[model samples]
Target: MASNPGPLTNWPWQKLGNVKYMVLSPFVANSLYSIMSKEERERDVTILYIYPFFLWRMLHSQLWISFARYQTSKTNHRIVVDKGIEFEQVDRERNWDDHIILSGIIGYIAVMYLPWAARMPMWRWDGLVLTILLHTGPVEFLYYWFHRALHHHFLYSRYHSHHHLSIVTEPITSVTHPFGEIIVYYMLFSIPILAMFCTGTASVSGIVGYITYIDFMNYMGHCNFELVPKWVFNNFPILKYFMYTPSFHSLHHTKFRTNYSLFMPLYDYIYGTMDMSSDKLYETSLKGRKETPDVVHLTHQTTLQSFYHLPPAIASLASKPYSPNWYMWMLWPIPYGFMFLTWVFGSTFTVERNVFDKLRMQTWVIPRFSFHYSSSRQKDAINGLIEKAILEAESEGVKVMSLGLLNQGEIFNGNGELYLQKHPKLKIRIVDGSSLAVAVILHSIPQEAKQVLLIGNLSKVSCAVSKDLCRRGIQVAVACKNDFYKLKLQLPTELCSNLIFSTSHTHKFWLVGDGGVQRDEAQRRALEGTHFIPCSQFPLAKARKDCIYYSTSAMIIPKALQNVYSCENWLPRRVMSAWRVAAIVHALEGWDAHECGDSMLDVEKVWLASLRHGFLPMVAP
Candidate 1:
């Protein structure tokens, strides 16, 4: 987390505030039936005659189709967890059977009463026309302006930022906003409704049907799950342009600024708001235009060529050497992990005896120690294990260090006093970016040391300390499991060079490295000593006959294991620019024996520029 709360300016839909319009469709329908003329009420075209039948048929069709599929595919009832894991559905008894009977009675009254008043309006089928009009063009045009307004600097901080709460949104989250926000979000919908209503509109039924259809479309579009059949997606290419596909909307959510059109891409195309279209054909072309140039251009093919890579070249040319900057490393978790290892494991890599006179030995002293709160509220037993490493360092002649003040406040001042009472020996000093305070403290020590142990928020003041110490020619080694875990998880795999959050079904070690080589190797060793319950195959274990039990924990292991090799530059030597790693994984896994429907896949070529670097060499060449 950053030192400050997220900026309000970045909230996705913050501008929608304090707007509401009560929708009384059923009331309007009922009133129409009660007040309508006899001829109007007696018309055969009344919705009262057709509405119940249409609804009954639709519901029955959905149920019968769904049930038939469920019987054929035994796993159809499985609820998708994380990654590829699925859970068997359990039957639940329902006591709300009476609600159906009450609903039918209420429905009968509304149907009979509404037709009488609504009969005159039904003559033109204006409701359907209005609904179709809204869906056709106007909505997207309205949405673009509203979306752009939300992004405006003046309005973004307060009114437009709330919708960005979830980086990845689910369909249920589509309309889940503050009550005030929802009104503004749907204000455009009311335009056509109001216009049609005032102009002898027959749009009431059409509007209702339009809303119901759009709800399904929007829900399916936002749903991360694969709902639309692949065959349909493969055959109907134009459908993607008209209907927002999951990938289409997901890309928008991921990028946030482009692709604001909903229901259709027409407005975005006309307005130049469309960031991507299936017509463009290659996904990478879109990303290539958007990704930071420096990041995308970094090549690993020839070490000599990358020696000219500006950032690393500048660092290498420095008259005085220091620990790697590790600034950008934190932005990506997996590379950060490798960088952490590259630092902590420096003792194994860094030249111990060197000709450089500025280099000196130093020892870290901890006057106090405390375990930080882990992602899991439960006490992190791993923290205790890490604390033992600190103690071990102390026994080996290094001082265990503690923070005198956290970024929030003085460590021992308010909450620190009680905390320090438990561990008194650890030194506490107010550390910001100012190195003078730390230097004064370090100078006070008379004994020469080889290493300094840093504890607490290493990325903050500790990062500065490491840079300062390493610049003075000290081998600055950092031991942070949290840092290690985070970096390792984000390291790219051969499948995709870019870092992405590894999808895991299990929540056990989300913030920890459960899949790193060290982590997995530890588990592999532990399994020999004890019978470990493989949770991935049997999450919340039950009697099962199938041998292929999906273990939530095991799924992430592949990515984590992939990280070690990917970071180490082992596999996927070539870059496949337009393909997503997940897409590649799906293709490679052969889980679905379907044909490679995307024949255009071969049209993709590696950017000779993209594969410029073979991976940052683990060693200083």
Candidate 2:
């Protein structure tokens, strides 16, 4: 259960246990036996062998819990929670003691078969050498097949799923499994001995080393931190062909169905289960030590918005307190309205960069928060859910959390200022990443164009954008629901000189407002043009290739808000800019948010921040 975990490799008694298990278990048992009488010696010697193995497991689990609890390389999200769609941790923990006892018995049974009288030790270096060869060959190959079988839906539901419940693995997590799966695995390890004895190559010395080495490597695989330094594999290129590191196996636990080979990479490469991201994840882990982030970003889809993403969560909602009222389910046909029934819940999906860790990023998804939102009262409830996300990030030692898309409404904007004012003790800072995205959109606007058509030009953001374009030596045409300026006489000199009043499409580069209704037929016709930026002023209009595309939404770590409320909305740029900006802010917040100057012309510094921190667009090579 890992009831209480320490830091990685920080167990006070682990190295002592490892030394006793590997180098002295047999000798210790002999010393204890020689001191006893014959009858007692025989009775206790077998039991003595089990003690070292048991101690090793205890040490391994303790260290693993530490590694999992204090993962510095990346965040490790708990796969099993007390109450949620995920399997419950309590249910798994309840049977932990029994599992250890059964594993001990199985360990005793396996070791008892090896004859102690003719045991070989490393003094006969040949025995130790052969053991390594035999274990990695037959044992690793067979275990790969065995593990793949466990992933089958039938076996998984009954036996193997429990092990997978902890996606972010701790060292003890390597050994935690259903009794049936554990028993089957114990039997699999026995196959190496059976093969060696059958082939007349069995040596007790080799068996001892093999047992110790295999378990040690297994513990290393589940530590959830990369222990192998880059030089070991990079300088000695041949080792890369054979070795599997903690980052390698951790990916198996995470993405699953990849990197199934243990102890060696050879088999995984030969087989088809290796993940392309395995090496990248390893190098990322090796390089991810620059900064410690004090914040994380969270995003979600509303009920009607996330209706498709809700079946599994909703089906299991009956067991959770946040289940929707029956009436909400009745409105299922209405996507937006039905969302009112759901509550927000999310998990850290993966660890990203430490801000300047090569500037690469990691992310987590806050899948939901009480689904109903939009109305003034419902918005209040949504705000509470927003606080829940902030608190989660705060608990995770996150210093800052960035709001993206619908997460930052007009009332909820400004980096969750209300949250900080109300929850004075909560240390997490709120950031709206759009400051950078809007900067990008403003910076990216084509100043070379002389004429531009503006749709829903009366909207606040769009109106500001239009006036700014007029000031930038470009002609601006404004369309609005109500004619704000009837003629040139009514407009300011700067805008009236370049701007043309129009209720119809002008076919110039369009910067459409996110909202406001006017000349419905004209707007529809304007959308089909070869060049047009869609109705979102917040992400800004800076596209030329196509009329419709999803907004990239940010300057740094751009994100595509395509699945939920924003999916129907098109982005001017293909990549998700909003997510990128949020990703950048979440990764590290060493700079001041005040640097995002309000004036579009004064955005060079902010634009440089975007470029320096990877907030720029993903242009083709």
Candidate 3:
């Protein structure tokens, strides 16, 4: 330790090559926020961690609630009540202090000295963006599934049902989960960390952005009144396929089994669990309509599922993969600690998620590396993971499952093929969802477009885009890497143009790309005055404001999820691959009601399908 001890010696290793990219890393930054050395930063980790969630909540929570109260006081929007249930004193009281304290306590433990889960904040814009992007997939998939899990007989009776206590909601209800439910939710946020570790680092702003996003969504969802202007959804109905409204969430609070989505309504729309009541409720709330909501208590077993089960707290622990880690020890004491903390802090604590029969639990860590990045041995690990997952599925007797994202590639490239060859007894059929997803992307296209500008690797889904448009006699302007002559040879001469950008008044343009020189060019051109359809998983930067941009991301959202915010990221996962499977399934099943299949896809068919399925129930996006 004494051999070369100094600032330089203590420094994190950095290559000359990497020095240029240090701004990309957390190691170097011109900003004052990153002035402290990392080791010293680690010492301050608890504070760093606390600020984003706990401290931020301290600053903003009361403000939102106060704002809600102020707004409500100013109008009938606050006093109008849901007829489904009467507001109780406990609801307001619980939100005012109980949830806040509980969140603080939980945040303290998670971001504190917990070696396994700690991630300090940083200010890099890229890190923040990467972190936000990384968490999108896992949160949507895991939360949607786990959320459904909470609605199961065992989980709902003891815990998740606690969240449903609000038939009519207020902003405070956003964080008003029981201890058990909150615990699971924190686990969901950790997905970004897992992603960060795999991608080599995390971003402070990214986590902050994600939290801000989810909490804002949570608050918006719980806010009793729908604040969206009816004219916006009516004038630009295409925007409705972007996300949930306060009324959409309010309906879920009352209906219980419907609207079980976390980030976007994609999962619900694809899975067909979207409650038809959402739009009407949203309109009712926005119009300042209110009625008493039915306060009928719904147990998961009785109201949703028929299976009798253990209490959720018990089920959560018993089902957890065995771990004798510090999380468990720290977790078991949380209940007692929570009470003590509440008593000491003088904040009231509710006994909602405290199921006595249950034990403390922790989510098993699953790294996102195999899915996000490729590696030497990661190939084997992915195969093994897939095999294990299949075995788990087989144990559960699930007959069919989709191999999503990276796993779909595992079917052909890695040991995934060997498993299929050797494990003949593993009768579960594995389906790749991208083909159907391509169909869905095709389906999301607008019918009125006479021409399409296709970007990115004009292969796979992009190729499908070319084919789809070409089949419909739509001119295709493709921007990709292949030699234009060679690509021209592969495609019909009449269908494509090497000049990727068109100055001519093309009726419509479609843009899609992954990171490359082509993507940059496409993005640049996209900023031009073209009515470009965004068909990527991520939102394009600096898109045109005046013209409409329909995204494949739109397919995941129901037309009812009215977007109230002006920040025009209508489809959040437009940059990430979150809902391709749902869109694929919906497209194949004619869930959008236009005839589509694996053999071929056409833009016109999809555009017509959009009309048929009411994909663009409104006018513009």
The top-ranked prediction according to lDDT is 2
Tens-place lDDT per residue, model 3, 1-621, is: 112122221112222322422322231121125335455544444334543465476556655654554344233354244232222423222333344444455555544445544545475565665665655566777888898887787777666555566565657667755545665677787677566645645555655566677777777767666676788888977656556677777667777888888757767887998998777666655677332111100011110111111111221221222223443453455434533453355321111110001111011111232222346555665455556655655564544434433444422343134555556566454443344446556555667766666655343456555665666776666544363444456566666653344343343555565444224444454434565544444445443565555544434323332211111123331121223223333323333121111223343444454445434422235
Runs of candidate 2 with Cα error greater than 4 angstroms are: 1-292, 302-355, 358-364, 367-371, 375-377, 391-397, 411-417, 420-429, 456-464, 481-501, 516-523, 527-530, 535-579, 582-589, 594-602, 618-621
lDDT digits (tens) for residues 288-348 of candidate 1: 2211100000011111221121111221111121223334344355433433553354221
Tell me the tens digit of each residue's lDDT in model 2 across 502-558: 666645476655554333444455545434554342433333333543333333233
Q: Candidate 2, 230: how far from true, in Å? A: 28
Please list the Cα RMSD from the true structure of every candidate, rounded to 1 decimal place: 25.5, 19.2, 23.8
Best by TM-score: 2
Q: Which stretches of candidate 1 lie over 4 Å from their true place?
A: 1-124, 226-240, 277-621
* Local distance difference test values of all predictions, in order: 0.33, 0.52, 0.46
Candidate 3 residue runs with Cα over 4 Å from true position: 1-53, 73-121, 230-241, 289-621
What's the true lDDT of residue 195 in model 1? 57
Q: After superposition, how far is residue 12 of candidate 1 from its true place, in Å?
A: 21
The lowest-lDDT stretch of 10 consecutive residues in candidate 2 is: 560-569
Count clashing pairs, candidate 3. 21
